[model samples]
Target: MTAMALTQRPASVLSRLLHRHEACRGWLLLAPALCLMLVAILFPLGSTLVMSTWSLDGYSVDRTPTLGNYSAMLGQPMFGALIGRSLVVATIATVVTVALCYPMAYFVAFHVHRHKALWLILLTLPFWTSYLLRVFAWKVVLGYEGVLNTALIGLGIVQEPLAALLYSQTAVTLVLAHSWAAFAILPIYVSLEKIDRSYIEAAADLGDGLTRRFWRITFPLSLPGVVAAFFMMFVPTVGDYITPAMVGGPDGMMVGNLIQAMFGPMNNWPAGAALSVVMMLTIGLAGLAFLAVGRLVGR
Candidate 1:
């Protein structure tokens, strides 16, 4: 009897609390996640903001609050060019990766009724091998006397290996696209898979062709995944330092490489912080604009 009374008392208390504030339970449930984001994301961002305002004094950091770091970053023409280059490379990679992966994703989502889990495992298998190893393999393949050159020479397609394959902007873009393909494909596949088959069947019953049905039902429903994939691919690729450094030679240098230099031999943490802040803000604005445009188009 006493045990039953205790449980009932708690239930009554919870009911009263819930009745008093409809949103309180929801907010309570979300508090842990919000706290986690505050610790992991907001704290680092706040620290970076604080660091960016510090002045650079000779070889050491000046704790004095000043906007010199931002002023210095804006003063450099090369900085602007690097940022532009990063955007261009990241965009190209995003587009190409999505283009290549979408058909495969579509195939798996629609045609492959059996071994669906196997296909997904295979898709992600390449990543299980270290990312650095894949880049290095590409480097070897693109080298002047590497496997590609050897195969081409053996086939008599060309008298000499192409010197232009490695350490260029083209190489950088290709490597980035390859590296990030899985990220793009999985999201899109999930989106396509989530779509109700009834919608497609209904469209077909209404005398719609395959193309019409896809355009009307499947494509629109899959866009949320596409948008999510785009952000996932674009944001990280822009900041990728290792791939660009390993295969991207002199011409392939992006803003990430520059940021790395600023922190490394240059010993300009404040300037790096400033550059990072601007880059983050630019990416956030671009993402917002993309979503805005998507919403308008959807309407």
Candidate 2:
């Protein structure tokens, strides 16, 4: 009995410690997710970081690590240009999507008295289709002699199809905006919906107008959602190669297109990895800047 009691004492103490320490219990609960992240995300990032330091020797990889790829990027103007273009396009798309969707989200949140779920479903219905299909659909609509051009010519709005309508920076921006509209709408709606009506009522009782109430109470309260929408929209758009490939011609080729080329036809794995790392770092910095701006605005 004394031997058995001694054997159980350590196990009991450990059990009690685990039970008493909320942080330990919390970590235990989170262990599965953390392990999955380690496998899926961190491992790949680590590999990429290592790969970025390696170089290619004609038809073979030099296992010796060097910063030649990073140095090459610094010397090349094209790399900087493409990255800048991607940043600009993504920023424009995020701004446009959020600006356009805000009113729709506000209407749905404030004006719709019933069938709110149905409205949300309807709003998101377009996203249920394949993203590729949506991009192609936009391509068709914006293409020369396509729907919009056909209508414009038929109605005497223009005698010729607008070549500039498709395969341009504007086209890329427009497609990105349309693609991410739902993402923007949902967050803004959730934020607006969660706003307390009593505050608005209180403001009204104090003789404030609708615009003033909205700017002061509603908009401020919904900034979190707006910030979320912007972040969500911006991050994905910046790395999008597909939309640019489909709608953006040579004039609108972004960093993602270049990155894809590097990994594909260029067959420069180290350079591609280095560019990817740079893009990831750029995104992290941009995201941090966005969060800082959001905090400042919130204050």
TM-score of each: 0.90, 0.92
Give the alpha carbon lDDT tens digit for every residue of 1-299 in model 1.
99988767756767789778969888888999999999999999998999999877888788888888778777889988998999999999998998888888999999999999999999887798789999998999998888888899999999988888888999999999998889999999999998999999999999999999988898889889888889999999998999899989998999999889989988888889889999998789878987997787666
Q: Taking the tens digit of each residue's C-alpha lDDT, what string does model 2 give over 147-218?
A: 999999999999989999999999999999998889999999999999999999999999999999998899
Error of 1 at 287 (Å): 1.3
Pairs of colliding residues, candidate 2: none
Judged by TM-score, which candidate is best?
A: 2
